[model samples]
Target: MLKMMTYFQGFSGHQSVPVTVDFPRSPPKLPSTSEAESETSMSEASSEDLVPPLEAGAALYREEEKAAKKKEKKKSKGLASVFSVFTKGKKKKGQPSSAEPEGAAGSRQGLDGPLPTVEELKAALERGRLEAARPLLALERELAAAAAGGASAEELVRRQSKVEALYELLRDQVLGVLRRPLEAAPERLRQALAVVAEQEREDRQAAAAAGPGTSALATTRPRRWLQLWRCGVAEAAEERMGGRPAEGAEVPESVFLHMGRTMKEDLEAVVERLKPLFPAEFGVVAAYAESYHQHFAAHVAATAQFELCERDTYMLLVWVQNLYPNDILNSPKLAGELQGVGLGSLLPPKQIRLLEATFLSNEAANVKELMTRALELEAQRWAQDMPPQRLDGHCHSELAIDIIQIISQAQVKAESITLDLGSQIRQVLLVELLAFLRSYQHDFNEFLERGKKLRSYRANVIANINNCLSFRTSMEQNWQVPQDTLSLLLGPLAELKSHGFSTLLQSLCEDLKPLFKRFSHTRWAVPMETLEKIIATVGVRLPEFSELQDCFREELVEAVHLHLVKEYIIQLSKRRLVLKTAEQQQQLAGHILANADAIQHFCTEHGSHATWLQPALPTLAEIIRLQDPSAIKIEVATYATSYPDFSKGHLSAILAIKGNLSNSDVKSIRSILDVSTGVQEPSRPLFSLIKVG
Candidate 1:
């Protein structure tokens, strides 16, 4: 029959100095980085080496036990001395034990239980005697000698000899709790390392002071040993605690709290212990520190003990970077892990806003200087333009681009200070950029106000509005920072548009109002050529006003058309006194036809762009065409029938768009039309609407 084989995992005992390898027996090759390979090579030939593998020591102890058992079988009287302490499970003061806790048998090895208490096994581990289980192991083997005994005794022996989840859980669960105590609770693993690390620390002190003529290398040997011990401890302590915790196991709320006070203190203790071993071989220290983040940080997160927030993730990355600043690139695993912790994840915009704001709070003076520079650059350009008081599109356009480029989206020094700055450090520059945007909005607005007059209203205002919107669009694309972060800087440009839209329109109205009124109401009755002048001035101003057109909407542009045309029709209708002589009336007839055609062309062209202006079209068309009294009744009847609800007052107002229409003409036209005015009062139509009595 084949035997079931159990192979012990390889373990190397202590060496006061690092081991070197020579592959002369095999093919010549570059030396391996493996500690085990070097340790094995050193043990094979080095006569000065003292330590042995744990399994070897346990095997040697088993041989001694077998001899004792043989001696006990020859003289049965010695059984009391052997079995007395074993069965009694006596514990010395402060001496570690392997006794099981009461009712904790379920936690013992396999289905059956160990003879000693499990709590005692934990106590031995806490004391850092890596070989603490030897006594219990010996007793279990001695009691379970099945070759010399029967099936019942063998069953009893197997129950007592079985290994439990103790060592696996010690590495997986208990050790992790010590490292991240904020999100974990058990303290045994930390206490265990503290005991072992303290012993290693004392061993170094004695080794260093042993000889006066010790070489520098010899004196540092124990320190190097301590450093390696730290690596080993961190490795064992941070064994993967992945998957779900056993049912009913607690997973802490790490998201709600930002601080890791207990864990931080443990980290500091680790750093202090590892710090002394360095001036010699500090990469070991750095390797161990980064392992804290790589292994433990993930363990806690995977367990739902703590979430890796952006700030915490950034800090951990930086802390690990500092651990190996001079050689971080060489440690690719650490660098890769640091970069992956949260590097590529997109943060929510609101969180980014908070982060950016926090980052920029300290750079107030620099931010102000950038804003000043942007405004001064614009102010200088404005001075060189044709209309000095006129708003220059180029200047404001450059201003928006310059302000966003120089201040709100400055190139942050991310690479140079990788160790000094954390991930949240990105937020610092971002916040300042956003602050610059907010503070200088008023500055942009004031610059806008300074050049209120539009020299070429169509080309310049659109250029200005397009430039502002374009600047924002370009910043969003070109800025090296996150798109979400850069978008916050665009808020101020919208403010400029909101308030600046009204300002630009008001200035245009002030310039053109008198011209519009003269053309509409002049009693001298200007010629067809004069109507061209009105078409050129007001023609250029209406419809595609660049500022409004850039943010164009049907309802809004149509409303502008209505407002301009409403004034035109009302004032033009009031100019009835111009005609008296037959020669003058004939001359006025030509002028009125031209004015009506020009007005009709105006409404038709603009109404095309803003389709809502279409309903007002016919009203302006009829108003401008009304020249003779015979045509008046027909035009009035057409309007009343088109809008059957239009009242006599409304009919009179509609008839008043012609300057020649008088009270007698309007009264006779309405009477002929018989506008019922049944119930609906006269309300002006939207597109061709004119403010009238």
Candidate 2:
């Protein structure tokens, strides 16, 4: 069959091939068929004769299978190419299999042709076999290099720069793998550098924008570092020294220094630029300026130190003083410091005097001289027109002056000191007292005469009266009198006479009689009739006595003998005349009881003598003997007529007598002459008859 097929394949190539073929015996049975049918049969037989055609089909199938095998071989070769690229360390230059392959082909046909899982990519990166990642890495490197090289540079420069960039990126990645993780590192240094650079840039821009004169470079820059330093110092100082100091120690110096350096220029500029913004702070500055001079005086060679410490210290002081002026004033340490400096020595005499006066006024001696000195200093400071020093000087001077003025006006009267002095001194005091009283009255009257327009006139009058009374009381307590001189001096005053000086004198005597009695230890020796006669003689003529009758009747009478019934009829009549009302009579009775001796003496004087005594009877005889018959007769007649209820003529006759009498004598007479005609007659009938009607 092979030989035949071979020959047929050769013959076919040389000759024409049949269009149809059929089976002989089986096909002869179909001769009766029509020509079209025969043609159809021939067509069918041609379709059925497929042996050679099948062989042809088999050959085509084999060709298709061979073509598929060759395609698969090519695909395997492409896959091997990609796998080699991925697995190789570097591409071999001239090796066909190791040559650069198309990206899509490599990607599609490689062992890792499909999308890589995260683990695979990570493993690939970990292994440092980045041939698979080279293209991506190279692209990134190029971008970074371009960025680093800047757009203004050429391509070659960019490429050359890319090498360093790639190296740096790889180095970082390698280091990240080898060292501790980047998550552990701090980012602060980078951030800080960035901030610093940014600030520097801003500063430069600001400087460039500024005009020549306005430029911060020429002015502010020179002080910028200093300013920053000062600000830092100030903040630290404030933190340390913001509060009040401890008991004895002062504020820390750093605080003041910081404030001094930082705030001084700013403060001055603020004062110039915006004075109204900080009134209190400005005031503090002024106060500090003033206090600086005060504090400067204490330490030795203070001027040099002052120059050093002045500005800051002044600022601090001014701030404190303005806030608390009184507190500053009261600071004893500050005061002592000021005084030590002889600040007061610089003041004018007048100002010093004023200060001294004030100290004297307040009774503070220790500070008086200091005050005076301060005043002097103030004057000097003023004269110098040194405002910084003047305030303290003026304050001290004014304070001293005020103190002195107050003290000078507080003097007490000399009479208040009378008790400390002797009677001789008292007598002088009394004279002074009298003079003062008189002057006071004169002044008061003058004040009134001056139109009574003065507000203090009445007050002066009252004060004078009080002073006079006080003087009198003082004199009475201190005055020493001889026993013999007592009666002689007081006799006339004891008499209750008329409304004149005698009355006043008599009141004084009466008031003083008991004091005398206590000293004498005896009854008064002077006859009551004599006292009466004296009072009657002196009363009308004494100015006080007359004035007393008009202005002070009751006090005037009380001032004289408190009891007048024991004396002569004139005394009784005067007492009755002065004390005419029922109330006055009752008060007089009470007074008599209070002063029994005086009352007895007065009664006995009036009861023993008649009111109408003989004109020839010497006043001395009547006073001594209590024998004024006419005075007695008049008293007896009046008593009988006045007391009709008492029918005892003897008692009535005794009562009528105008000389001092005792209460016992009157009682005895009343008992003996009770209603009986025999006892009704006077005991001294002869004397009574001598003045009978």
Candidate 3:
């Protein structure tokens, strides 16, 4: 029962059953600003990193408001109320005339085909100067009108052909500019490419900082978001464009890449660049993430396929997601367009969802797999083994560290992904490792069985104890994790090691159980060598087991003393008559006194255990020296009465050793004891219950 009690309480310094862990809600993972200075090793993120391009949206809203204000002021300030109606017609009349001059210029060039050369269109789009393409579009439309009107001449047909060829040549030129080397691409294109490229570099750094822990991406939710940074390109563009977009007759604000910043940069340069070929890139990046998500959601974690995917395919997907966040372009989104929403009204706030949901659905499944694997292996190695095996430290360490690595790596991504599964993984690993160590009880059983050769058993138990201790020490010394998670995961094994040690002490206690009986009639004082040998059991496993020495030593002396007293009483009974004469009595008593002196010397020389013998031995000596029958009877009765459980044979032995009592005297002594003990039956002896020698 003591051993069993120790077993349950050993791990925690108190009792607690293992629990099935629930995934904890991961708090919003903010990029650790301290990581730049600490082991996390991530790039430092100051508050300004997430600040949107300040001039992007706010300035545009104000400008549109200012323009509306200017228009209303002009209408009101134009004339007196009486003439306002007449001037309103004049204003309408003035609008068409404003276009007449530009139309005249278009008509004048109609004969010459006003066609834009391939060089002219490419250079304009690459520089994001879309206004330059308008005259060319105007000429193409005029040519189409002339052809449809059935008016064709030699030069008309020739110039029309040139305008017709402009379409493909213009498109190919734009695509070529879009596909230019990224560094040489316009600034806005470079900004998008630079941000993505930097994110990739940071991802690699995070992976390495995760150290030896298992990649926690396996347990990650299928959805993950990573925040992006701006490096002055978009803001500089907004500052130059005055936060206004140009479309068609002006610069076409291709909705190609819209920064989700407060001042959303329409990425006019990206517009001109990607406008020709954005859809193809979109289909390629989105297609893979979308297709993989279906298979990921369909499979359960228990399947081996899911395990394989979690370790391999999932990591690859993560790499892809890193390269292209969400697999969806972060250009712009359709919000509310039921009626008239003027320009900036459709501008959406930067989205706050995970950068991608492509990875979220399977996080729980991966979490489940880790725990399921741990519990399954725990059940296999402990509950089902035919003969218990020593805990394979290397194997279990790898398993524990694998779990740790998974959590650590996941944590690196969690700054963006919001993984709730990390803490649970660490907890399950702790429980598994603890369970593995606790299974050492079988080896302990073998250690006990080997106790006949006390030295060897002591050596074996000590070695096993130190092995558990060393394993725990190594774990504490090397287990790497974030401090908060580290606090929760480590120390479980230390408790198990402490428990194994306590059980070892208890094993020593058990081995000493029947040993006291060996000290019988002639074996009076326990031999010093024998007592020393028993005391040494604890010392062999010492320093680590140092605190238990007092307890073990005390129990040892009590066991030895008990056997000595029991055997001494019987030895007294075997004595030859002590009093044919006084000389004979003295000789017999002296021998017993000498043995008692040896016992006292053994106790004083060795340890604290024999302090109990100091007063007990002298009183026993006085009782043994008595030679008168009446005195012997008084002493025996007093001693037996004091120690009520002492047998009648014990008193008889004392009387026989003194040789001072005849049969009549013995009978008389018995009658006195019989009356004292309230003996009611005549045939029954006074100490009939005792196993008297």
Clashes of each: 13, 60, 16
Q: Lowest-scoring 10 consecutive residues by lDDT in candidate 2?
A: 1-10
Please give, for residues 306-345, the per-residue lDDT of candidate 1 as tens digits: 4545344333332233222322322332344334333221
- Alpha-carbon shift of residue 324 in model 2 (angstroms): 11
| Residue-by-residue lDDT tens digits, candidate 2, 499-572 | 22232254455653443333123222334434445455334433432222122333444323322322332232
TM-score of every model versus the real structure = 0.36, 0.19, 0.31
Can you tell me which runs of candidate 2 are displaced by over 4 Å? 1-408, 411-554, 561-693
| Model 1 ranges with Cα > 4 A deviation | 1-373, 380-396, 403-463, 471-527, 536-567, 573-608, 614-617, 620-693
Assess candidate 1 and give its TM-score to the true structure. 0.36
The C-alpha local distance difference test score for the whole of candidate 1 amounts to 0.42
Q: What are the Cα lDDT values of the candidates?
A: 0.42, 0.31, 0.37
**Model 1 lDDT at residue 498:** 50
lDDT by residue (285-343, candidate 3, tens digit) is: 22222222222222211121333433333333332222123222222321121012222
TM-score of 2: 0.19
Q: Better model by lDDT, 1 or 3?
A: 1
Error of 1 at 497 (Å): 5.8
